[model samples]
Target: MAVTGGLIYRGIWKSSKRFGPFPKLAVAGILGFAVGKASYVGTCRNKFQQLGLEGGPGSGPWSRRGPSGRGHRSCHHVFEDCKKKDQVAPAGEA
Candidate 1:
């Protein structure tokens, strides 16, 4: 990530003279991605707390399940929701 950021910064700096609005766009894209990742991590933490597994031994927001054994179930539900939407999309559209 640092490498990519460095490369982007270098490119922007090297072309600042001719790239008028492009530098702003590139910087915005990088910042947007950083913000999005941070937001997703926050959401995951909230989900962990809601599931009652905020800080279990091996079950964290990034864990597959809680130490109480509900980690997989929560992960499963997230994917299942997406699958359910996809399955219902055709009927809804028609």
Candidate 2:
């Protein structure tokens, strides 16, 4: 879904194809991706929260590394000991 949204955004904002620069398109791609992802994520999260669930984070997902020594995991990710797993990423690599 984000990829589709990104394509739409890229067409609208990058139609100019930048002017007289080698890196202009690269810059545009970077900016377009940031804008598109932020907008898409914000919209989806807002819509989900609007459903009126209790105490949901703004991302509709929690972060790992809770204040407690016990780790936390959002629906989007699994819990793992980051300190111990620094040598290798958690399985299913996002």
Candidate 3:
């Protein structure tokens, strides 16, 4: 991103000499690296599944340490129980 911004700045803002193909090559290299890593990880996942292994040790590819977007199931149960009690509460305790 920096290289791209520099190239654009030099070409338009400064109107100075271009940085040749270096900036383009740098961007391409960065993108290529990202694609390569994704492909490698995907290959590892496929092989692991083929071997019938559940998950490996030490931050395995199959392990998801991030949020699943569904929130926690235990928290949902607690909230449901609270709602149930609240519905049954006496009118004097409102």
List all candidate RMSDs to the true structure: 15.4, 15.0, 14.3
List runs of model 2 lying over 4 Å from the truth.
1-21, 50-94
By TM-score rank, best first, the candidates go 3, 1, 2
Give the per-residue lDDT digits (tens) of candidate 3, residues 1-94. 5655566657753332577556565666799789889889867877766775434243343235312122323232446765677679776442
Question: What is the TM-score of candidate 3?
Answer: 0.36
lDDT of each: 0.59, 0.52, 0.55
Alpha-carbon deviation at 79 in model 2, angstroms: 26
Show pairs that collide, candidate 2: none
Encode model 1's per-residue lDDT on 11-85: one tens digit a residue.
743435676546666776888899999879867777777766555345554566532343344433446765676
Candidate number with greatest TM-score: 3
What would you estimate as the lDDT of candidate 1? 0.59
Quote each prediction's TM-score: 0.33, 0.31, 0.36
**Once model 2 is optimally superposed onto the true structure by TM-score, how far is the C-alpha of residue 31 displaced, in angstroms?**
0.4
lDDT string, candidate 2, 1-94, tens digits = 3453465466643433545332445666688889989878767766756775422453334445442223454334544565456447556432
